[model samples]
Target: MLLADGIHAVITDRHGGISAEPYTSRNLGGAVGDDFDAVLRNRHDTAVELGVDPARVVMMRQVHGRDVRFVTEPFGDDPPPLDAIYTTEPGLALNVLVADCAPVLLADPVARVVGAAHSGRPGTQLGVVPALVEAMATRGAEPYQMVALIGPAACGLCYEVPAEMREDVARVVPEAWATTRQGTPAVDIRAAIEAQLHKANITDIRHDARCTIETPDLFSYRRDSRTGRFGGFIWLDGG
Candidate 1:
């Protein structure tokens, strides 16, 4: 959907490609033990479906850190170990692959800057989204003018975590602290991200509330350890 004028965003599910079981169809991640050829094909198909040039799509080798990169073209064979990426060039789509981590898409239509980030428990506590906002600002984007989309991820009720882990993350982002339906410690990564965005002065935020762990149509590492990954894509119109 359109996040703003000229900015397009999409969150894909685990369907429509040509992979086998486990990574069964529409798996866009390349490092999840899926066939490399199938992954390439799935990537191509996803870009085609989005009306974008597959060769221009960029993917990251996410490391659950706050590192961000500015890109103008595809990363090719070896993508860097970064959690966020942005581009000022139109048609150069930025892709974030995730099974349970929140996929974040951001755009400042007035400045023509677009960014995508993989914000999991670690990345969220590390302030990856805030780092992304800072990076985009260097390219003439401002948080007040940016629109953000938090894609499907493991919700708090479904993302039970160890008490210490929850406490650690909550220390960094208190909004992440939560209690699951079963009354166990949990971290609401997406909620934490929203809070971060709000703190950055970004008010036009949107969300795909489907919890990956609860939604069968979506990929979830917490649900199935050996699972495929869906994608969240964002790009500007016109090449």
Candidate 2:
């Protein structure tokens, strides 16, 4: 279990489970064209490893947008199209899949709530982090009391975007240009996420110092073109 000071979570790597190559071992997403059985087994293994009930661990068909799903109760049904999820309920594990896109986990120790955000360019533009924070606040969470951790993702040095894309990012965040490298602009997704967290008054933020595109151990969608998804899961434990 990858335990934070106040929450239970794990940022799963591409090893240790059963999936064929490309997705070669530990692919948790069944909808990513991985075999259903393999995906199920992989998820079960991850849940057990993280100490969450396999039944309470929930994953949605992520649409890469800003839709935030508010979880007030536990259920086995497919969640609505959303890129962010939050819950104050114990034993409810929220899972988000990512390869190069950043997976962000937020927890409020005082409020006893946890949230997960999927921050691709689209999800960032749509303000998924703020949306998750807002949802948590509705469940009696205070933004300033939260601690956020951004898991492994593609770093700014490796992400080269077209000029037009850079301008698009500037519309929301003007400093996005500073994260660029050379003429080809690249956004520091982790930095951008931290900025958003700051804007929401979330002070205690952490980031894994790993870049998927540059690291062989990590699965990168952009690097391989076809790759398996990695998981970032968080849940509140019932004491």
Candidate 3:
């Protein structure tokens, strides 16, 4: 899965690598209890596949809140506690690991600035997408010219939530409020995110309609809590 021009944006699935069961195959999440070595290997392989430098690839410890970071260089060892990361510098790959939460890739090719965000239910309610656009604005990127790409996540029909929770989220992201196949309350994170993008004046938006929970090819925390996480990456071509 790839998108945008000039900027390299790739969505990684659970298909290759050496993480054992539960966190089977291409699991890039190191903290999910997957073999640390395997996670490192997967991350390295993912970077190589994208033509990005493994040493410069940065992954955030997503807290599911609206925190954005401007990366000029890689974080030596510790991953930052953030949900979104933007960078104008090339060679550094911004990665967001997700099992069900929507992974968003944003880029302003003209400005050569790109961003990656993890927008979960809580993050969506907190308006993480808007926060990301604002962060990009600081780097001379505008919403109108940005291209937004949303990756696989849990769909409304499969993301049944408590009525009260749905109401709370709806208050913030009304576009997400939906009904499940069983007549239960649910939230379409993807729809809510797309609505947010439109609200930000971003017209060039693409979505990977494959639902992680429903699609066996992707990792799904809802379907398998102990499962591994797939990764979404965005990088500028320094060359």
Cα RMSD (angstroms) for every candidate in the order listed: 0.6, 1.8, 1.1
lDDT (CA) per prediction: 0.95, 0.82, 0.90
Error of 3 at 165 (Å): 0.4
Q: Report the alpha-carbon TM-score of model 3 versus the true structure.
A: 0.97
In model 2, what lDDT does residue 189 have?
A: 74
Q: Per-residue alpha-carbon lDDT of model 3 for 68-187, expressed as tens digits? A: 999888777787789999999877889899999999999999888999999989999999989999989998998888999999999999899999999999998899998999999999
lDDT of each residue in 1-239, candidate 2, tens digit only: 44455588788899998999878899887777778899889989888887787888878778888888878655456567878888888888899999999999999888898999899877887788888899889888898788888999888887888878877886786545534355567877777788889999988888886999988877898899777888999888772
The per-residue C-alpha lDDT of model 3 at residue 8 equals 82
Q: TM-score of every model? A: 0.99, 0.93, 0.97
Model 2, C-alpha of 28: deviation from truth (Å): 0.9
In every candidate, how many clashes are there? 0, 0, 0
Candidate 3: list runs displaced more than 4 Å: none
Better of 2 and 3 by TM-score: 3
In angstroms, give how far residue 221 of model 2 lies from its true place.
Answer: 0.5
Best candidate per TM-score, number? 1
Task: Name the lDDT of candidate 3.
Answer: 0.90
